[model samples]
Target: MAARVGLNGQAPRCDHIDLLPAVEPGLPECKECLALGQAWTLLLVCLTCGWVACSDDSPGGHAREHYRETDHPVVAALAPETAWRWCYVHGRIV
Candidate 1:
């Protein structure tokens, strides 16, 4: 599958992306959703503060929530397709 491109047809530099911590291979769960007894289809970890949240496809959309709350722009997929990273601020994949 193709990684998502920005609507503007430009991919931002990965170096510009804010990464607080490398993805955790050990913990594959979304902490926030688990606390409420919810399951997640996908997991995204905030690249700024290493916060874990469920993807929009999942029930809570906590990944976007983390972005809204902290403006932490980049998030790496916590599990599947680990090569891709998303920028919530510019709305692109890097």
Candidate 2:
């Protein structure tokens, strides 16, 4: 969903970009527990449950791991000011 600034307030619009659906949604927390350690390079936002995970190429691959444990469906790049998300199934930006 795109963040919109309305006259009176802000609104969130679901752009609905085609992307690969996550294989799983209810994945266990990061096994390596890197989540508790250092900062991450990239953040993947789970469209299914809004769980944020680190990119697969990172130390833990928490993002892809989230997909393996839970079929949440959608994920977005969680970078600052970058609201673009990706769908794994469709391989498109959502």
Candidate 3:
């Protein structure tokens, strides 16, 4: 499905995105990935409780693991300007 984009690639049509809490500031790195000597391409931050985990594409896929263990629901990209958030329950990026 094609998403509506505004002046800055905004997609207000994604109402679920509004319900997701913003990622807490800080948490610059995936502590587990670092400790395990694994490199991550992307990061997911738990909205319910601030926990940073590696993305599914990463070696360990800790982000998805976190959802499985905690069912926290949403996670926003760690990088600025990405403007992407995923809802595990819904299985889509909003």
Candidate 4:
């Protein structure tokens, strides 16, 4: 997969693209949300370690929290229809 490239055919503007896993893992639900007994609207997978967490719009906001704690940087939407990645450091879709 083209880990460094975005849908627009531009390389992501952050250094964390190099940290993506060879294969982004699939997960059924946001583990953090489940643990917190909260509901989530979107799921995101950490590109660095394949961590699954809820989007910022969710009550848990675990995906953004994970980045704040780990500095892992990149996360991709886990929904099959959303083929986009987000860079936490840059605060934009990569």
RMSD of each: 6.1, 9.1, 5.0, 4.8
Winner on lDDT (2 vs 4): 4
lDDT top scorer: 4
**All candidates' TM-scores?**
0.71, 0.54, 0.72, 0.77
Task: Kindly list the per-residue Cα lDDT of model 2 for residues 1-94, writing each as its tens digit.
Answer: 5465434464333344333344343333433446468455666778777677777667777877777788555686765577776655545554
> Going through the candidates in order, what is the number of backbone clashes in each?
1, 18, 0, 0
Residue 89's lDDT within candidate 3 is 76
Cα error of candidate 3 at position 71, Å? 0.8
The TM-score measured for candidate 1 stands at 0.71
lDDT tens digits by residue: candidate 1, 1-94: 5655545666634454634555444366788888999999988877777778889899999999989988888888886656788887667677
How well does model 1 score by local distance difference test? 0.76
Which model, 1 or 3, shows the larger lDDT? 3
lDDT (tens digit, per residue) of candidate 3 on 4-83: 66345754354455666654655768888899998999887777677888999999999889889987788878877787
Q: Which runs of model 2 end up more than 4 angstroms from their true locations?
A: 1-39
